[model samples]
Target: MADHLPPVAREPAAESGTADEPGVPRPATGDSGLRRTGARGASGPRQAYAAIDLGTNNCRLLIARPAGDSFVVIDAFSRVVRLGEGLAQSGRLSDAAMDRALAALQICADKLRRRNVHLARSVATEACRRASNGAEFIERVRRETGIALNVISAQEEARLAVLGCHILLEQGEGPAVIFDIGGGSTELVLIESGPAVPRILDWQSVPWGVVSLSETCGPEGADATQRAARYQRMRSLVDEAFAPFAERIAPARADPPTAESLRLLGTSGTVTTLASLHLDLPSYDRSAVDGVIVPATAMRAIASRLSGLSLAERREVPCIGRERADLVVAGCAILESILDIWPADRLGVADRGIREGILRSLMATGLRRDGAGALRTGQDAV
Candidate 1:
């Protein structure tokens, strides 16, 4: 999954005097009356909203307060729990995977409480949707972590993703494609720009992501020749899965895509990691990677180079490290397939995704006070 920081505003310091966790917020000091006011200039203390996105590979959280038309991130958390590690083979979430996810969620629950978040939404994607024991896992998370995990469908996932990162898309004519390459599935959305948000023309979600594809195609090869063959096989699998979506959009593209004719934005670890490699950054940097457009040829070259390396060599590369080395190859295959169909000259990379989308949804429909003096959220505001 991509990092959850919103591109509009920087994170502010916590109210407490002491330093807080890197992105996670610390508990506020003094009485609640001393807090800052809401963006609407209301006399009451500002309401902190939180969003948690639990994906097949990572668990991430974002906390923010309304700021004018956008929101400023106050705290955040992200962890790679590989929640879908063995689900493809067993058709269920492994005990270890669930344990890892639970641990991360516990930390998220702690942060939400510390920040005194007014309203929040926690969502689980493809992993939970596919596993036979997904609902059981949601119950376990709620019981153990006090966080209700909403298992959303693929279409909703795609919609939220487009809502989150569509702002980063370069200006262009015709329709634009925004895609999210996840751990268990890849979502491709075809949309036309609207007045406030992009109107979804069509979308498709395929069951091929980094973890699932890597596991389904077997381990990375030991030698260059074998690795090339494996890469080809992975590409073939993604291509076959995307065939229907590709054909559906063919009628819309009468002429070939040029820099201005086709616009493509990608929100996921795959595109962001590839963008980092393209910039030759010593380490991963969200500020540097987010919203930057890179040449399609350059991205494809980097993916090609990474695919040729052995697992050990990939592990040694900056940004990828041990956690991503095994799975990035699958990401590369999925990304290459996207490029083949869209054929955009430049690719827009977004460090933001579903969590940001959730925040936008929450903030757009301002919370209201209920008869009992507690806050109540609006319905389907996004």
Candidate 2:
């Protein structure tokens, strides 16, 4: 489940010649009067920051050190824990799922210790948000693995996703859409871009992601027609959930957005996996897939093809394997439904999301300027 990539930090393409807006200061790193204190003392090496995103399906960790404005990833780990495996029907995390997640957390704990992580924030999304025993589980994780998992709200999930991946957004005039299709839910954020950091206009979260959608729709069909029907059902469910958000944003655009006007970016395993397939790569490669743009039609075609594929066929497909075969169709449906609403000619794919967002926030001085030119703290600066 760990999609390994070489350690590297590539700056995203700059915005298309836009003046910096007042009060929208970009995240400043070490110069922000923040000091790094290691286990030895303040005179030791730079502080190592870590962020853990325990999603419904994946347990991911990122360890990095601040470098100028951006950060270089020192270590990273991801594993498909499926913490919400049966939560949809049970309304709680199953014992097996908890055990699976705990095992992954143990690995993360080992990494944090070995890396000498100074400041680390671990947040759990959708599954824990809806589970009845989520708090109990968080406490259990702390006791067992020495890792505290913060169950973040859906709104915060969307905000962090936008903060993490907005840099990969294509330069455009109107508002842009940034989305994260997680394991148990999907978050879409609409932002107005001008400054180095885009200002969020509105956002929405729908409790329909690969795990929930696939479980709700039942397993993949036994045949092509059945699979196609299941895929359509998944799309319909997602469309219904997204309808309200779509209507709310419709008035913001008087007419349909042209190719140059609309900017759409997606950060999730779904998009990254599909991008890898779109490139026909021999295996998953973050360097090639990250920040790459693919035509919307091409993406749609790939989704359609994937939807038609049987589970076994999908498993045989390279870059998918057995790990993602069962859930990828639901991902394709969610992606297609998103394309239907936003309809950007080209889709920007980002391999980074919540973990990166958390790292940036942790490295920043936790201070920002408000619209009225007053200094503010802790209100989504990063």
Candidate 3:
């Protein structure tokens, strides 16, 4: 873990921003950094907690102060770096990809420092897990950015994703499933949870995310026929990967899920992006999408429509620009597969996940003490 950050480096928005606006990923501001109105929990001064998540598709950071049962976010940053761009074939983190990720990490480090973060945890996901040079890259990050990153296991990844989003699960009596369709992998967590919070009953991580699936199928330049065929093929692959999990949950599936008995929650670019489309927003709005529930049929329609579009046509979609156009269909494939297995009426979207999980862990355990600092930022008089 120490080797992952050699001490170094590290976006956006048109949104008013907060938990509701995790969507609009801004480009790294570079020298401009980010100007934010500092915030903190009313707990006098336990200082602030920070979390950084470096995924194959994006790098994000969140700083907050524990507020009663949860934390109030003071600042946040996210950028789509596509860190695992070519790893599917190369089995390595490409030079260009590493450069992009390193730059993002640097920005996160600065935010952490400037915020006077009392406790911070950073983690890297599937891309790093699969890269042959992943360890080396993490070490370099630590040295260059002065931030340490933990490359977590699939199980831990599933757990954290659940920890981050389960609070948003719909109130119900039966079991629920929360999944994250990421860049290089997808995690599905099945839990027999109710109002208090869903507990992880079982979970699965498939090595197919929007980035990896698109890479595997190469749908960018294909004609409509080819793109549709490729999208189905991607779905087929995800279905196969998900088979075991589906089988394992057969007992739970005995009665099937209804809107009231079972719920589906999703945390990832795929779900959030799809939610934005479902609402037909002029631009991505986290508040509009986050914790919002959409009909499963509506989500599938968006996915199918997107699959039939040309790469150029996709770039014209509101929330999806050139940055996400190519990867959206693959995400659709993963999401559709999830909907199929679970057969739920509605799908819930959560913009918060790993970062929130990390913050909860730190604050809950006193792993990082509180009352040591007063302000959310370094400014003395906040």
Candidate 1 C-alpha lDDT tens digits along 227-319? 999999999999999999999998665454454488889999999899998888888887778888888899999999999999999999988
How many residue pairs in model 1 have overlapping backbones? 0
Q: Which of the numbered candidates is closest to the native, going by highest TM-score? A: 1
Off by over 4 Å in 3: 1-46, 194-197, 256-260, 367-382
Tens-place lDDT per residue, model 2, 108-225, is 8888788776667778899998999998998899789877677887877887788787778876687888999999999988888867778888889999989999999987778888
Q: How well is each residue in 148-257 modelled by candidate 3, as lDDT tens digits?
A: 77788788788878878877777666677889989999999888764454567888999999889989886454577777778879989999999999999877865553
In model 2, pairs of residues that clash are none
Supply the TM-score for candidate 2. 0.86
Q: Model 2: residues >4 Å from true position, as ranges?
A: 1-45, 253-256, 366-382
2 or 3: which has the higher TM-score? 2
Say what the RMSD of model 1 is.
7.3
Using lDDT as the measure, which candidate wins? Answer: 1
Score each candidate by Cα lDDT: 0.81, 0.78, 0.77
Query: What lDDT does candidate 3 reach at residue 17?
Result: 22
What's the TM-score of each model vs. the native? 0.87, 0.86, 0.85
Tell me each candidate's RMSD, in Å, in order: 7.3, 8.4, 9.6
